[model samples]
Target chain A: MKIRTCKYFAKQSVKSIWRNKVMSLASIGSVMAALLVIGIFLILVLNVDYLAAKLESQVEIKVHLVDGLSDTIIGEIRKEIKGLSGVKDCVFVSKDKALKDFSESLGENSYLLEGLEGDNPLSDSFVVTLEDPRLAPQVTLAIKAMSNIENVVYGKEELEKLLDVTYFLRVGSLVIVAILLLISVFIISNTIKLTVYARRREIGIMKYIGATDWFVRGPFFLEGVLLGLIGSIISIGLLATGYYYIARYVEQQMFGLLVISLMPFQEVLKSLTVSLLAFGVVIGSLGSMISIRKFLKV
Target chain B: MIELVNVSKTFSDGHKALKNINIKIDNGEFVFLVGPSGAGKSTLIKLLLKEIDPDQGNIIINGKDVTKLKRREIPYLRRNIGVVFQDFRLLQEKTVYENVAFAMEVVEASPKEIRRQVPIILSLVGLSKKSNLYPSQLSGGEQQRVSLARAIVNGPSILIADEPTGNLDPDTAWEVMKSLNEINHRGTTVLMATHAKDIVDAMRKRVIAIENGTIARDDKKGGYGI
Candidate 1:
């Protein structure tokens, strides 16, 4: 084909977009809404999984010392534990400090502990962190056999529950993504088919005039892509703003100890834009092709 | 030149539209394809355009067998043939100039050539002043003229007009025929299909008349074979 002919078809494709204004708007609106919803869920799930992961990293086993252990013994235990490659940090907490901390956590129950409070029932021990949180059990076992250590307590149960939650979320997110993508394609295909049905006469004319399969189909395909692109942009913009407030409120009100990264706004937008555009382009083109296929006999 | 030998088109519903059709149209000949309604007139045109193919037969155009042509080669085949339709199938959104330029565009005519040939052809159809007018803005006769301009802009050797004057007043129909006659006089083959006996009588061109899907008469100078 000549360059001028290519330009003509390109122009015709653009004119076609305006020719069927209502259908075009409908396609773009629905695609945009769907993309926006999917985008929001994607961000939420990703961040929740990330926050859970951060919680996992912080999981550690606390090894308390026996009563009347010497300062030298405490120091020696700390050195030995730190020397272990998987151990991250080993903070030594005295019994008195532990009692004070427990009282604070106990809130109004502190009055009930008044008899035990002055005596400092808690023992001094190392609040041990591990380089690999999964090695918490092994690290605790090693510490329990130490001379001055009396007991070992950590977020063993909590970490296990956290892992369960992460596993569920990872699986659940994939299922949701798959369902959403399927829904997107189905809705888009129907939307494009309606557009094609409306323009059957134009298609007939194009075919009778010897318009190639691509020439007749190109504009509609382009419209589908443009719809997806515009829809994704609208969705991403709304998602970013909405996510900012949601993340801020969640961070402020919930446990700040396990803060979630909402992820940088720029990265989310850039990736969503590319992905949605690709999605829209493929879906739109596919929808258009499927819709117009019956009419493009020649 | 166009040649159709032993062409037959049967639909899935077991209706035969054309039967054992055989005809040859040489370059620079103006002919009329006439018949009653549903007489397989459109089917013949479709076979030539490959809009619908024949079940059995050969269609040779300019010494090339179109029956064996690839799917991609249809556009190139169309580049050499121009068509004016009954309803004046002009792109509704486009202006007269753009509509005429579309044929060239489909064939990839350069911008310089479009700028050069578009106006001269628009004038040939007597639509020079309406270059910027949309199809809806024009009268039925004027719209058909725009269609004519669009059809002939590519300077095709053969022009297939399927009932070109079907929707026009008698005066307008004559005007369209006059435009077609002028093109024929310029040595371009014109195959016009019409049920209007008056136009065929007036033109006195070679007429190929079909009745019930088979060639009934081929006249050197005829008037609708009435």
Candidate 2:
């Protein structure tokens, strides 16, 4: 294709789109609405995943030691736990320090532990954090077989349910996004079908005049792309504006109220713009290509 | 030159449009295809343009078998042939000059080439003065001339006009026919399908009359036969 020919195609596309302004606008609006919904859904899913990950990182296992364990045996137990694959960090809490912290937590009830100072009932413990909290059960079972290790405790059911929710969200959002994409393509193609129908006679004339299939199809393809690009840019602008306001509210009003952190506007903005632009172009071009196929048989 | 050796076509509904058509049109010859409606005149034109394939034969244009040409090669085949219709199918949105230039553009002619050739073709068809006028703004005859200019702007070796003057009055039809004659004189082979009895009798060109899906008569210098 010559540069002049491309210019001609672009000119023809713009002219046709302008002529069918109502139809073009309808397609653009469809694209915009579809993208907006997808974008919002995407933001929600990503934020949920982020919060789930944050909560996952905070879960830890408390390993309590057996009574009368020698100091060297407790040291050896800490070393063995540290060598586990998913262990992030290990901190040993001596019984004396544990008793002191327990008393502090009990506040005015510290007097209840005064008579038991000589024989502290609290077991010396190890606070174990993991790289992936989902591995808590396996790591807990492994630590239970260690010498002087009495028991391993973690919120088992809570972690399992959290992982299940995360898995469902990722897969479910993907299915929903795929369906939304199909709907967007359908709307766009139908709109382009009308444009093609209106100019069907012109297409027939062009075909008879020795216009190649590409020459006949070039303008329609460009028309679809233009519509997609315009719709994407508008939707991105609307989404960004909405997200910015929401992010501001999260920071100013909901910071202390919600434990889950909202992803910053700038973090989501880049990927959202890029993905939607690609999506719009794909939807628009695919729609036109499918709509114009039967007419080109001439 | 164009040749059709035993070309036959049957529509999907079992209507035989053209049966064993055999035509040999030499380069630079002006031939008329004459018949009533459904007489296979349009079918013959479509076959020559490679619009539809023959159910059983070969169509050769410029020594190449068009039936065997690949799907992608059809455009180049059509580029060698220009076509016009009864409706004077000029792009209504374009002016006379742009309409002619559009044909050249379709062939991907260079911008400089389009600029150089469009004016010459417009002048040849006597549409030079109306170059800036839209199709709706022109008289019926003027519009037909614009279509004629468009047909030849790409310098196709063969010009096929299917009822080019069907919608025009006698005088206006004759005006378009004069332009076609002039184009034929300039060394381009012209094949026109028509039903105008007086124009056929007056032109006295090589006439091939078709009826019932076959050629009924072929004459070197024929008139419209009763």
Candidate 3:
């Protein structure tokens, strides 16, 4: 590009938007709406994933030792559980300790079991927390096969359901976001197409006077980019301001109850601003090119 | 200078437009391409502008083979040539100044150049007082004049007007023709295609008449004679 001419065309593009005020405004409005939807969804997805991951990290599995388990055999099980890939922490709970836990869990029935814990009716067990809950089932099954492990209790159904939900959340969010992004692109492009249709005569005149493809296209494409950039900025601002009240309310209402942290302002800001700006500029230009291409053939 | 050598064009529906046509126009000459309807005049002009390509032939402009010019380079070639269509072709949304300034902007003229050149060109087309007027606010003659100003403002080495007077009254048509003649006198090669007998005869410039897409007559100082 001849820098001066490129700048001139850039300025003209900006002017064209103002000159065709109604259409330009419509285009900007549609793009902003599209990007806003996308930006909000992106932030929501990121926060949900963060929260699910935090909760998943705290769940654990219990492995019961076999009847008549030897001290050396118990040591071996500890070494084996500790060596398991995702095992974050492993501790052997003695049979007496297990009985005490059972009794305590019984509440009013604890009195009925008061003398039983000394007899150690409960078998020894290992408390195992894995780095990832999704991997817990496979590792727990392996521990159940060990010589000293008689039974395993990790709420298998519950763990599976939690992992399935996380997988679904991650996959479903991505698919929905992808579909919405495609919709956003279509909306942005169609809006630009309408603007181009309105300016068809101007394009013909421009070509008749010797403007090259890029020259003729520069202003419209720049208009697309400018619209996109501005739309992104607008959406980011709205999202940031809106989410502030939402996060504040959520934090206050569920202060001590929430198992996961509320989304931070910075993370939301990053997702909102980055995605919208990218959506605006890239989609805007592509839309402009598709719209203007038919006329530019002249 | 523009030259066509054995250029032929056939539409996809199998309609032949230009057939083995050959013509040469020197720099600074004002010439009319005259013919009846279906005589290939508009097709020939479209070919020259690279809006349509010849199926079998070469087009040389300033000694370069325009047929071989890249798709992107077609508009660059246009910069050295100005075209005024029969439709007036003024950008309806912009003021007269904006419409005229658009030409320079597409080619990326500096703000300084735009500021200096646009007013002069608009004035040359008798539109100085109406710089802020849109095409909707102007008469048919005035709109065509704006298109003229836009075409010529860059001072192209060649100017092409394809039936510029097609929709004007005699007086307005004469005014548009007069603008073309003045630009021609300034040494820009002028190639105009018209079926208007009165305007053609009145100008008394070299005339190339076509029949069935081939040049039938090339008259020095011709007067709309077939």
Candidate 4:
């Protein structure tokens, strides 16, 4: 294709869009709407997965020592827990240190623990962080089987529920995105079919006058791509604005909880914009190709 | 040159549009295809254009078996043949000049060449003055002339006209016929399918009359025979 011919086809595509303004707008609107929903779900799933991962990494199984255990036996227990499979690290918190940390956490109520410091009731334990939080049950069982350990605590029920929610979110988002993509393609293609149907006589005339199938298809294909691009851009714009305001509201409501922070707009925007643009182009072109295939048989 | 040897077309609905049809038209010859309604003339034109494939036998144009041509190769074959339709299928949105230029553009002709050839073709069809007018702004005869200019703009070796003047008044029909005669005289083989008896009888061209999906008569300087 020569540069001149490309320009001609581009001009023709723009003219066609202008000529069929109603259908063009409808296509763009539907595509944008679908993309917006997909974008929202994508952001939601990503943020939920991120927060789940943060909470999972914070999970640590505490192995409590039996009362009156010797210093050497305590050291042996710490070494055993550290060597356990899935254990990323084992930090030994002595009874005195646990008592002091708990007192500090109480802030103004530190005096309540002042008299108990001499007879620290808190147990000296190994705070064992696992490589994967999902292995909490297995790791907890291993620690419990060790000698000189009284009990293990890792918030088992809460961790299981968190993992389940993340799993569901990942699968659910994928299904929703897939269905939305299909709907976008269906809507875009039908809109293009209307355009092709309207100009079927023109296509027949072109066929009779020796226009190649590509020649007949070029303008329509270009038109479809343009529609997709416009739709995606609009959707991205809407998504960005919507995400910014929602993130701001969430931040305001949960100011101290940085662990559940929404993804930074700049980072999400960069990747989201690129993927949406590519999706738009693919859907648009595919729709145009399918709609015009039957007409080009001439 | 075109040759149809034992070509046949039967619709899936069990209607035989053409059967055992044999035709050969040499270079630069003008031929008229005369027939009544449902007499298979349109099917024959379609076969020649390769719009629909033949159920049996081969259609050879310029030494290439058109029936065996690949999907991509059909366009090249069509480029060698220009077609004019009964309704004068002009793009109502385009001006006469753009309509003619579009034919050349489809085949990827250069801008310089299109600018040079479109005007000359429009002049040949005697529509130079109305080159900027849309099809609706022109008379029926003028629209047909614009369609003719578009058809021949690519300098096709064969011009296939299917009822070029079907909707025109007798006087306008003659004007359209005169333009076709001029094109034929300039060495383009012309194959016209028509129901106009007076024009066929007066012109006295070689006539291939079809009836019941078969060639009933093939005559040199033949009149329209009902």
Candidate 5:
């Protein structure tokens, strides 16, 4: 097509959108709403996974040593635990150090432990951190099987539940987002269908006048793309503002008590904008193309 | 030039629209297709336009077999032929000038060519002064003239007008006919289908009368006849 013709078609598309303002707005509104929902779910799932990973990293198996083990045997046991496949680090906590940490945790109640300071009862243990918290059960089992270990604890039940929740969130959000995208496409296409139907006579006249299929379809396709782009940008703006406020609120309320930290808005903003724009454009153009296909047979 | 050799079309519901049709028109010839409402005049025009395929045999236009043309090539073939409908299907929102210019624009005609040719064609159709008027502001006959201008704007060799004056009054119908007559005089082959007996009898052009899916009569300088 000539550059002049392309410009004319683009102008026509913009004119059509302006002419059918009501339908155009409705289409944009639906696209924005759908995208917003998808965006919310996406951020929620991503943040949940981030928190789960942070929590997983903090999960460490504590191997309590049998009382009165020699210093040489304690070193051997630490080496064995560190040699485990998932073990990232194994640091030995001496009985004296363990007692001191317990007294500090008790704060003002340190006086209750004053009589036992010279004769510490706390067991010396190896704090074993793992490369993957999902492997906590296996590592704990390995630690328990070793000689000179009294007990191995790694929050087995809680860690299993956390992993399961993260897996479900990822998969479930994906399915929901896919369905939302499909619905957005349908809404957009149907709205465009009304515009095309309203111009059926015009299209017929064009065809009769020897307008090629592309010549007739080009303007409608452009209209759809523009609608998608506008809708996506607006939705992205709303989502970013909403996410920033929520992240600030969560940080203030949770303070360091909970490990649930949100991903910073700037980190995801670029990719989110790009993907939403792409999705909007694809849905809009595809909708227009599909709805206009039947009418172009002339 | 147009040629139909043993061409036939049967609708899926078992209605035979065209049966064993055979005819040929040399370049620059003006011909009238006269028939009753269901005499298959529309089907024959559609076949020539390649809108619907003939179930059997061949339709050749300008020595190219239309039946063998690919889907992508149909538009190009259509561009070489102009079509005007009974409804004068002008875009209501567009001015008389834009409607005509649109035809040229679709074929990617240069801006300079469109600016130059659209005025010339509108003058030929006697709508020069009304170039800025929308279709709704024009009379039925004037609207048909705009349709004519749009049809011929691309400079197609053949013009197929199906009942171009169907919605116009008698005097207005003649006005539209005069435009077609002028277009023909300029050497574009004109094929018209109509039920307007008076126009047919008055013009006395080459008339091909169809009846019951077959050509009933073909006459040069023929009047309307049952």
Candidate 6:
């Protein structure tokens, strides 16, 4: 297409949009609303996934050892534990170090543990980190069956609940997104259908004047894209503002209590921006294409 | 040049609009297509424009068989021919100049060329001063003249007008005819379909009259016969 022709199409599209301001506004609003719903859900799914991943990274198993085991026997037990498939690495935590950690955790009440310095009741243990957090339960059972290992401990119930929630959200989000996208396409196209119907006479005239189907459709195609672009931008602006405030509030309220913090607004900005813009353009163009097809028969 | 060889058309419900039409219009001839309601005159014009295909014949325009032309090639063929309508079909929101310029824009004519050609065509149709006025602001004759300006601005070799003056009073209709005549004088083949008996009898152009599904008369300097 020539530069002048592009200018002409742009001019025609803007003119038509302005000419039917009410319809244009309605379509734009609909697009904005649709994208906003999708955006909110998408942000939710993303943050949940991020939180689950953070928790997974921190997960490990504490394998308690039988007391008074010889150093060589402890070495043999470590070797056996290391041989397991899911075990990434294990660090020996001596009873004295465990006692020190417990005292430190007591903070201002550390004086209560002053008499236990020489004789710590904490068991010797191996802090076991795995290659994958999902293997924690199976790895724990294997370690418990090994000789010299008295017990194995992990946050099995919490991990299972978190994984289940993430999986459910992911599948649910996919279904919601698909449905929302279809509805947006329908609404945007219907809005564009009215515009095309209004100017059908002009289209017929252009056809008789030898205008190619593309030529006749150029302005309308551009109209849809413009509407989509405008809608997406507005939605993005509104969503970002709402998200920023919510993120700040969550951060202040939860502080260090949350195992995985809500993702910072800036962290998700680029992806959200790119996805929303792309979504708007694709939906907008597709809507116009579908709407204009029936009228181009002339 | 336009030629229809043994062309025929039947609607889906079995209405035969044209039967074995064989028309050969030479280049630069001014012709009139006359008929009463449902006499197949509109169908014949549509066939010539390649708007509807003849069920069992060939339509040759400028020596190319339009019936065999691919769908993508139809626009290029149409670019070589201009068309006007009884309704004047101007974009109501556009000013007179933009309405004419739209034709050139459709063909992707260069901006400089559009800027040059549009004014000349507008002046030729005597709409130079009214170029800024919208269609609704113009009189019927003036609107028709604007349509005339648009039809010829692309310099098509053939010009087809379907009831170009249908909505106008006789005097206003004559003003539009004068513009059509002026366009014809510039060497465009003009084929107009209409029911106006007086204009036909006075113009003395080559007349092809259709009754029912066939040509009833093809007269050199024909009148609107009873």
Highest TM-score model number: 6
In the range B100-143, model 5's lDDT, one tens digit per residue, is 88788778888899999999999999989999999999999999
Off by over 4 Å in 1: A1-29, A83-85, A103-115, A131-137, A144-148, A153-157, A170-194, A250-283, A294-298, B91-94, B106-108, B132-140, B198-204, B220-224
What value does DockQ give for candidate 5?
A: 0.66
Please give the RMSD to the true structure for each candidate, in Å.
Answer: 3.7, 4.3, 5.3, 3.8, 3.8, 3.7
Report the lDDT tens digits of candidate 5 across residue range A55-131: 77788888899999999999888878878898899999999999998888677888889989778888999898888
Interface RMSD of each: 2.5, 1.2, 1.6, 1.2, 1.3, 1.0
User: Which 10-residue window in model 3 chain B sums to the lowest lDDT?
Assistant: B85-94
User: Model 1 — interface RMS deviation?
Assistant: 2.5
Worst 10 residues of 1 chain A by lDDT: A255-264
* TM-score for each of the candidates: 0.84, 0.85, 0.76, 0.85, 0.86, 0.87
Q: What is the C-alpha lDDT profile of model 6 across B1-226, one tens digit per residue?
A: 8999998999999999999989999999999999888999888888777788889989999999998987877888888888888888899878999999988888888889999999999988888999899999999999999998998999999999999889999999999999889988999999999999999999999999998889999999899899
lDDT of 6 by residue, A1-298 (tens): 8887789789978987897888788878878888898788778878877876787787899999999999999999999989999899999999999999888877789999999977788899999999998899889888888888888888776667877887887787778777877777777677778778888888887887888878888888999899999999999999899999998998898776555688789977766799999999988898888888855564
Off by over 4 Å in 2: A52-59, A64-125, A129-151, A154-159, A253-259, A294-296
lDDT of 4 by residue, B62-124 (tens): 899999999888888888999998999899989999999988888899999999999999999
Q: Native contacts retained per candidate?
A: 0.32, 0.65, 0.86, 0.70, 0.68, 0.73
- Candidate 2 lDDT over A1-298, as tens digits, reads 6898899889988987898888889888988987898788778777766766777778899999898888888888889999999999999998999999878867788898887789888988999999988888899999998877788898676656777876787788788778877877777777778778888877877887777888888998898898888898999999999999988988998775466678878878987898889989998998788787744554
Candidate 1's C-alpha lDDT?
Answer: 0.78
Q: For residue A115, what is the lDDT in candidate 1?
A: 79
Better of 1 and 4 by DockQ: 4
Off by over 4 Å in 6: A67-124, A129-146, A154-161
lDDT of 4 by residue, A1-298 (tens): 8897799789978887888888888878877887887787778767766666677778889888888888888888888878888899999898999999888877789998889977888898888898888899899988888777889999777656877876887788778777877777777677777778887887887777777778888988998899999999999999998888988898898766444688878877886798889888987888787777744555
- Specify the CAPRI tier of model 6: medium
- Each candidate: how many clashes? 2, 0, 1, 0, 0, 0
- The lDDT values for all models are 0.78, 0.87, 0.80, 0.87, 0.86, 0.87
Worst 10 residues of 5 chain A by lDDT: A289-298
lDDT of 2 at A12: 80
